[model samples]
Target: MIKIPGEKLIWMYKTMLKIRHFEDKIHRLFLEGNMPGTIHLYQGQEAVAAGVCANLERSDVITSTHRPHGHALAKGVAIKSLMAELFARSTGCCGGKGGSMHVGDPDVGMIPAIAIVGGGIPVATGIALAFKFQKSKRVAVSFFGDGACNEGSFHESLNMGAIWNLPVIYVCENNLYGASTSIRVAVKIRDLAERASSYGIPGVVVDGNEAISVYQATSKAVERARGGQGPTLIECKTYRRGGHSRSDACNYRDKEEEKMWLTRDPVVILRERLTKDGILTPEDSKQMEKEIEEELTQAIHFAENSPWPKPEEALEQVWA
Candidate 1:
């Protein structure tokens, strides 16, 4: 197992916690009719975002999917801005133009997440293309669900990255089901990573619930990309604790399948490893959670007190 730095481990812990609490608040707010629009919570898949982001520099770019709260938080977007956006407030990161699924902060190198399935793949490839063309060392990373692997853009983007040796990392968070359809039934290939072979780039599978494993996998891929070694496809085998969106009950899933994944909860796995390895104490973990909860409370208050976007302003940002 790769040894993560103490500071980096703590940062990853905080990032994951922020994601967890942010989404939890969103779930509550949506339930109470305080929020509009659908939400794709990133509750169970926090570690993948934290781990991959921990390996990236401020200059490196990341593209996110519909389920992007975790990625946005891990990429350094402000909690206040995120909550405001969720509430459709004018002070949001995108000035309320982008809502829950589109949360992002360009100052931190993240574009508004592409809510469309597999939409980020080509955009990330384009960002990498620009960096490659400019001879910049920055790498672009894309976060997409397993369903995205079957999309046409996935193949086209990977081929473009390989053919040009562009600096990109394609991450498939294989949470088994793509909005109710299981990967077993959706794709012919057993591993999503195997598809990278067709593009002549490296691909591998990792325990997405394990932050250390994900960090290590992403570090190497980032390094390879920075060296102009082209792209890598990483299939993170994980599970989503929540349903596809606010309305989904996940009735299509099996009880046994849900039970099995609940045992592999990423936060629990990380906390255990931290305690067992003498990196953190149980009290420390609890303290961290409380601190995060307090911050989230403040974020909600900030968002609630903020003003909603003005109706007339909508036409201002519209393009012909």
Candidate 2:
């Protein structure tokens, strides 16, 4: 087991709880018809975001996918702003425009998430190129799904990042299925990390269910990027607890496979580990949960009370 500071462990644990609870709240809201648009919940993959973002500095930016709430929260986006965005309120991070798939706050170092498949890969690479040009040590991380690995943009971006030694990391969260398609059906390679060899960059695979494992891998990749070595591709093998979208029943997934992954729930694993290691007391854990619930409740209230955007405000940010 990798040694992590107790404080950091607690932080990761809290973050995972926040992501889980936030998604649960959103799920309920969506079902209750209180939220507009749709959501891609990050219920089971909380460890990946918490672990990876813990290694990043406030200056290091991350590009997110359509499933962005976990990334946004881990990257320090305010819960209230994100909730407001889902509520389509004027006070949202995107002023009620970006909604669920586009949640982000650049002041906190996350670009508004790109909903298009594999779209953010090249964007993150470009940001890394800019970082290199300016001689900054900051890194850019692109979080994409397994489906995105096959996209032409993924290949081109990796090639460019490798050639220029860009300060970037390509994190592929392989949750087995992309939408309704299994990764086995889409890609021939058993290990997606193998794709990195073609570009001459280091490739790594980690247990996405283990926060310490992910943090350690990201730390190494970030160190390499800062040293001007090049980009690193880290594939996190995780599973999503929920369906792909709001309407999905997940009937396509096998019950046995779901049972297996459920046993390894990241949040529960970490909490137990911390308790057993004497790093977290039951009292402390309970307090943390209470605090998170209160925080989320306050965020919901803020979003519910926030005013909607004026009709003309929609035209303000349009460029084309």
Candidate 3:
């Protein structure tokens, strides 16, 4: 039983809807050959981003993994700017330099998402250190796949964050696969959160497909971090409704497994929960859906007409 403010509940549902529609549209754009480069979509795992971010402030920073569109949007990045980034338009958050996997906006409390596996772990830990040194109460969160847990950076980052009592939350989106490889075959332990005990920090497992559960877990961790209780490793057990990337067909996963997770779809779950409680009626659902559609339509239009960066400007953002 998770209790959230009525307005916050609706906001969470809307955020999940936005992520769903945004990723769906991105998949379409890629198929139509209108989008540049390959994409690692955050289709089914909307709950992780929306749930966690609902408890955060605009000033609280977060770091994202390759699948970052959801996190960017959840953290308050403008939809138009995000769509433009996917389109490689000059109006993008990274000025057309960061597309798809690199989607982020510092203005919205997200740095350009780290495309490398386990790369952002140490970066986020460092950001937490900086926050501590500056005496700022702000917290930093790092979102990574379960595969990142095996990386040395993950171990080092967790250890360092624990020892320093850094204000960071390590969110492991255990979608059960590190790309095409299954988590079952990779790690001996089914629950990755258990590894946090080695570092003496709180490790939690949450229903990542359920927005309320994820929100509650994150809210507690955020509160603890804000009170200087150190970092928490939250492992969210969820599934990626789509392939690992544009080139992946996800043929390796069992049909039954995908079907099971699909039934627990985050967006649908939230809507039903709200509707069941009479917080959201049939008409309210329709209105929310319509508004989201309109917003996404505007985002697409903005991306379509946006300008591209000049060829000469490529070297401008690069450092020698």
Per-residue lDDT tens digits for candidate 1, residues 88-161, read 99989888879999989889989899989999999999999999989999999999999998899999999999
lDDT per residue for candidate 2 within 1-320, as digits (tens), equals 45678888899999999999899999999999999999999988999999999889989999999999999999999999999999999999999999999989999999999999999999999999999999999999999999999999999999999999999999999999999998888999998999999999999999999988999999999999999999999999999998999999999899999999999999998889889999998899889889999999999999999999999999998899
lDDT of each: 0.91, 0.95, 0.92
Q: Is candidate 1 or candidate 3 better by lDDT?
A: 3
User: Which regions of candidate 2 fall more than 4 Å away from where they truly are?
Assistant: none
What's the TM-score of each model vs. the native? 0.97, 0.98, 0.98
Q: For residues 192-290, write the lDDT of model 3, one tens digit per residue.
A: 999999999999999999999999999999988888989999999999998999888889999999999999888899889999998999898888889
- In angstroms, the error of model 3 at 208 is 0.3
Least lDDT summed over 10 consecutive residues: which range in candidate 3? 1-10
Off by over 4 Å in 3: none
Please give the TM-score that candidate 1 achieves against the real structure. 0.97
